[model samples]
Target: MSRSPEFVVKSPAMDIVIHSLSDVGPDQRRRLCEGARGIFWDTAEVKDFSSETEREGFIYKYFSYYMEREPELFFCAFSDHQVFGYICGVADTRQHQELYRCADHIPLFDDLYGEYPAHLHINLAAESRGKGLGGRLIEALEGALRTTGEAWGLHLVTSEGARNAGFYRKNGFTHEVCRGILPEEPRMLFMGKKL
Candidate 1:
């Protein structure tokens, strides 16, 4: 079996702290979202979401509708005083239902994840992307999922144009389906890993 990496793993000179989103105050949330949006907006071949209102709305809705409901499912990676990476998943059935209701117009979630549990969403600032924080964030989410004893697999949907699919694959997620759920948007790739 592959051995697990030590819990204290860190980049050469960076001090990393991994904690739940609940531990981050509103101001920190704003900072993290702004930093993360800067990175996501510049990603090659992915949709740009740099508009202040759009990014703010995305982060606000995520915290209000999903993370707060399942606090353990959201995690942030911090180095020093700034949040460099973050991951959030919907592990509660009711929250997932609410997401569906709110995202009905966004066909990717409405059609593909309508019946799925534990839908993971992750983002890492460009400067923090190559330090293995992505895998650590996924591991943290898996740990949280295990605590629930649900035995169900974790699932996620990524845009085909986003290179993030490779990162998910490296962390043991497999592409299970593809749905043209959004006619105006790119194809959505649904991936999962049995837990």
Candidate 2:
């Protein structure tokens, strides 16, 4: 599906169109993830898992699951026919329950999603960074949430020092919790924003 191109208020040079992730093919998903990895690596949020093979594996699993099971909840931003950003959220109570069940095996899963608001994960490629695509993405997600009668507030967890905390805060998210290691590794920053 296509969307009307709209200019990002933060960067007039860029025009973005947001669409559901299901509308794209594997090749497009690969391109989107590649661009996303560039930004993730540059920010040093994901590095312990070395090699492109491992990285792609992680993305493929997560995104493939998202597309297959929750296509309507994921979105991709495009410009000139290329994916420059993406956002995905989980609003289904059943999905959230499954997350809690899976998290029972992981040490901190309980604290992360426990008593948390409905939310999603959003990311933009480095080339598309600092252009207000982030805010636009969240706005689009909020629109989707409104249609479903889900809560207006959304939450996210990201590793500290990712430099994305500020970006999220600027868009509307606020810090809710911070824990873990320091210097290089640390717990994620739990953030939330009210729609």
How does candidate 1 fare on TM-score? 0.73
lDDT of 1 by residue, 147-193 (tens): 66653677777766567778888898874677675488667777878
Deviation (Å) of 78 in candidate 2: 0.5
Badly placed stretches (over 4 Å) of model 2 are: 1-14, 22-44, 47-57, 60-62, 92-94, 97-115, 181-185
State candidate 2's TM-score: 0.68
The local distance difference test score of each candidate is: 0.64, 0.62
lDDT of 2 by residue, 101-177 (tens): 43322234345444445667676777777767788888777777776766656777676666778888888777467
lDDT for position 39 in model 2: 47
Clashes of 1: 0
Pairs that collide in candidate 2 are none
Predicted model with the maximum TM-score: 1
